[model samples]
Target: MVTDFIELGFAMESGREIPQFSRFEGPVQVITRGPVPAQALADLDRLLARLRGEAGIEINRAAPAATLVNASFNASDVPQNLIAVEFLPRRQMQAVVPNAACFVVPNVSNWSDFVANRRSSAIDWTRVVSRTQAAVFVPSDTTPQEIRDCLHEEIGQALGPLNDLFRLADSVFNDDNFQTTLTGFDMLLLRVWYAPELRSGMSKAEVQARLPTLFNRLNPSGRRPSNVDPGPTPRVWQQAVEQALASDGGLVERRAGATRALSLARAQGWRDNRLALSLMLNARLAPRDQGEAALDALLAAAELYRRAPGGEVHAAHIDMHLAVQALATGQAEMVLDLTARALPAAERSENAAFIASLGFLRAEALSLIGRTNEAERLRVDSFPAARYGFGTEAAARARMDEIARIGTAAQRLARL
Candidate 1:
């Protein structure tokens, strides 16, 4: 646990004077003055008070780290602050503050701990990737590599064949391996196979010809889909869509198809909050009709969830989705309305990411409404420094770009 804290401290101190300490510019530094006693609550308090007095700050006993570090640096008032105290016995520390923020003792020493603590919850790869990117900021990149490899191994074990196919496509697309990678047409074919409605138009030969044009336009490397005719089969189209959706490669037309799928799903009964949120995301590359449909579905979902029992957070999620969708669709009024409804729910839920997302969404909405100062403030407030896991970096960067666009748009409006 102590080692973990040291590692965390080092992570926090990256590119700073302190080797493995938080870069807290504060007046008081209450040294532990000796080994921590097994039962020294009174002594700890006295030290805390003295430190607070020296720092000219009110002694907030409620603030776990107020006395240890200056009041300004206390991240949370949780008792876990004691974990930062070096040379303290693990047992003694545990005894002193069983539920304190002092130190987090990881269950296991290595990857085995993850396996032991594994839960049945759906994995959010975005969060995992974000954490991995943050770890890159650390001096030692070994931990990030281990985490990435472990996550990949675990995901490979957990996901189904379809998901595996999608992941492989993502890898090829991201790596820009288009010549050998799956093509946009291949992904389209996969969609046709999985989703029956998309195959309404044209024959197999026409699709094959269209596939190359779409692939050439979408792939970052500008390589067309293989001309080797897979013959006229619905399977070909399904393969193409599946490949395109999974691939990291960018195909404008493929993106349009994904948007259409989201819109179609929204038209169906699958317009749940999660699905609506996904559709809103898809709106970034979707056609106007698809984007509008997604935005409407997200709004309806938010309203539905809001009225349902025990659905406040779910409703908030929907509202956040709606706000994001509104921004993507250039619906200023809708963004403001949805954000106004979602902010309270986000606060009630106390979800930091949700709150951050709300702030970002609000910033975008405010910008659209010509509120430049407020938009900028919200953007800065919403910027998250360290996300929990991997894949989150790309999402975070994208969100940041959205925030920047809002700011830029607001500036442009001001000029007008």
Candidate 2:
């Protein structure tokens, strides 16, 4: 654990610096998209204070003032010269920052996925203090334990050194993403960044030359940084797996949950086929409210799964979603093309319940394009498998019959 900190320090001592993550020139203000719990906001405030407080003392750096901006924004009511930290929902994200990556909010994050299937996003952008806008968001669904850790990491990035070091175990900079508080090593890095000698716009060479002096002053005691836990902390992978498996929410909620799980998995650089498939399904079957955005997610996930090796099952599921989106959006040619690819994949899949879903999707797509006879045959073939998925043979048959008449699969599991 301590080695993680030592390694991070050594890397910083290396002769270069990330240019975009240069420090903020002024105080930052925290704005909530909703009425965030008071305690959560307070906890975040305390974490930011780490730059100048207890964490600072460990590295011999002075603490800074703790202040939160408590107003909503508009041209008229905007706070002057303070960076805004907005906490909002994912769909509402484009409002605060139009860049696709800024779309992360509590409960949902369209934070511009790293890739559709991989789901890992480039979070570094959020921390960069752009000359025009120095801002970030606090997702409303952020876990309580994570409030401090996230603030330190994101705000730390805002201060400078905007890149994440996946190698660090002693700091929140790594993608393990489970650390909930600032570490001593992180404080040292902050010390190196804010050292008076290292000015805001110092070139790499200038910073590199001065780092050794800062390092020595900060680590005169020669204590190595260690994770709060002696062992590696829990990983985000398990959290993603659990969310993928959970069946607690309705269709829209479940899909959103899957998207988040996929995002979490992607955030940690974890790669798993099951999580990818869950994400694909959720995006493919998105509720009406999501419309084209849902289709965008489906297309991205499909492309991601398509490129991944040994993901034939996931590919088939993606195709099925593609066909679903096509038919819903009235793209007849795409429906025909996507279903033709999806049919045999369903048959080849060894999972009976999944095969039933694919079969139902295929039949629906076929009927949408003036192929009634073929649609009925496939629909009938799907019933036995669909019964298992739908929980009763009668309900499954009713669903198929409804699809045949209405040419859509709106109520397949509406009971949920």
Candidate 3:
């Protein structure tokens, strides 16, 4: 646990740069730009409240107060110690980083500064001595759930850790993206991050020396008789996973990368969450005709997650895939069973999109069983989340129509 904590705080994502401890020394003030949705505004406020109550970080929601004219153009001003969260159009965000959902950067107060200094050392998280201002970019045109996910991650980064660790099963700090909201572990990390013993620019050695005493004080019960380090993630495996998931990769390259990642995980003798993730990715990137293969991989990943600690959410995510397969195969009972088991976990994790998807699937399953009224109720109940999760009424309706078509086809097949 100590090792994970230190690595999370000290390590940079690049894996080559020297570790530099950086964090905010003062209260965090946030201002938003663009057409920031009301849900986003509400979610940000809730997140700030959590930071205050759970992580003990001082933060407040601040509206845009002043217009500052810069050398090039005029924009809403963000003062020092403030984070300017700009909600860009989805296309504009994609132009910034293809397939990027959202991101945060240190030492920049607004979007312009972020773009200007993004390539320079000015935005490099490793070099910062103390955080004064930062910028968070989110896509305005995305779902409500996406908005909240981005807020949780980007704001957490703005105030705390800069790197995401794969080993963490229970944190939004993991690249797995399974845990959409901040978990208990994430809050603990932030609590320790703002603890009086640490500060910006501290070296790894300095922080390491202090962590034993610190953890004993903050989380004394977390100590175990035997501590196992899962060890560093192999760079080759990391690269393979990235290539497999990254949007820029061609289909052939992505499939090859997934295969390589799975092979590496096997060679490493890892039966942990990393192995499960590799399996899940392999399943996700599998070709449409390879449905059986995809199901097999997903089932394996689901089993792995079922046995591991902090793996409920991982299993729930896999269940979504499993439910889709069940729906496709005309296994209505299986779809209900899978979704019923998964929904609680998804809801607990505050994964709005997952909740919405599962809800729609469950409704279809009910209708297939001749439960029309119940199915209607379920579908109606799911509407708000669907609108938020799918981002628009048309998108939600399309998903419903698609699910309905699958059910109809399944019924047709059963008759044939």
Candidate 4:
């Protein structure tokens, strides 16, 4: 005897067919057509017993039995003992049989719904602000007012109108159009403080050209706000030195004038720490006949950093800048010594970018002292890690260009 089971009632919206499971006893048979038979009932009882044992349930507790019949296959000669039982689709079975545990089948259609049900909340800005301040090494409540009020009264007089300046600064800080606001206020401040005469002399286009340098002198430590979406391009603090040189005549008078204004402002309690440092550094690098005065100014800056408590990082940067100045001035021995001192600080602080930079400086000093091979080796060793940590792919590319130039220069000199 044979048995066949077919489930017709169960279906899914996705049009996919569902599978059915059934138990069979004695050779269950499928009938195309059948009458009520006693033997068939016996076969069903046996199948139910087998199913109950497999499911670990008693016979009475098992689900209600279903029968299958087809008129086409009915025959008198067929054994009356044959019975056919049909099982519903697994999903339908769960709905029909109370207390019968069923496993849920998953499908791709509701993936987005699952994700939407489990989504999280938005970020908290206050916590973000605190964390950002900590990461950047900025102190809590380090606002411009606290900085401005710390300077001497005489310095405040040099700043012209304090109320107007503060208002403009506030606007710059709060406005979404940071660069535009900064540029506008800085131009006005420059006119009032530095070169009142030039304000009337130059066109808007000309004023815009000179605005960047003035802005740099004003906010030397922070990144500038640019008109473009990504904001101002990253400029090294040393660019101020170049600007000072390129200013009217060979004197770098604008840089000196800006520095004096900043110093006065700082004395009056202006919190221009970064700007102040940049000005001092530019003053030291200024191309004046008075080398002794420049050296003294540079020493004063270094001393300021050295004397300040917990300013070791600032001191390290000063040391590196001094070393670079030494290299530019043909003092290779001093460059090597300063770089050597800076390396430990750079490494101890885990500033790989600084370490890599010092390595390059050391290499440059070495090359100047007729140690080409050593210089090349250091350049090759430091290039990769420095490139990664510095976050300036173009600067790294430029360094490689410089290395190539140095190699070419060495080769040419050897031929000579």
- Candidate 3 RMSD to the correct structure: 2.6
Query: RMSD of model 4, in Å?
Result: 33.4
- Residue-level lDDT of model 1, residues 23-90, one tens digit each, is 11212122221243322334335434532433222223334333242111222332321212222333
State the C-alpha lDDT per candidate. 0.38, 0.49, 0.83, 0.38
Write one digit per residue (lDDT tens) for candidate 3, span 1-416.
Answer: 67877777776776755467878788878777777788888898899999999999888877545423232223344467877788878898777787678998877766677777768987877778888888888988888889999999989888888778776788898887889999888888899889999988888889888888888888898876765558788889988988888887899999999999999999998888889989998999999899788889998998999887678999988887788878877899999999999988998898766788888899888888899899999888888888887889998888778888888888888788
Q: Is candidate 1 or candidate 4 better by lDDT?
A: 4
Tell me the lDDT of candidate 4. Answer: 0.38
TM-score of each: 0.33, 0.39, 0.92, 0.35
Sort all candidates by TM-score, best to worst.
Answer: 3, 2, 4, 1
For candidate 1, give the lDDT of residue 373: 99
Q: Once model 1 is optimally superposed onto the true structure by TM-score, how far is the C-alpha of residue 315 displaced, in angstroms?
A: 4.1
The model with the greater TM-score, 1 or 2, is 2
Stretches of candidate 1 exceeding 4 Å from the true structure: 1-285, 307-315, 324-334, 361-380, 383-401, 410-416
| lDDT score, candidate 1 | 0.38
Give the clashing pairs for model 2: 52-63, 106-140, 120-266
- The sequence of per-residue lDDT tens digits that candidate 2 reaches over residues 1-416 is 22333333323322233443254344444433344545566666565566666434221111222233343334444443344455555445545444332322211122222122123223333223332233555555443333334455555544444433432434455443323345566677776665566555544556566766667777777645544332322244334434544556466555655666666655645433434544565565567797677667666656655554324445666676566655555565676677667656445433445566656666766666668799789877777666544546676676566544434443233223
Order of the predicted models by lDDT, top scorer first = 3, 2, 4, 1
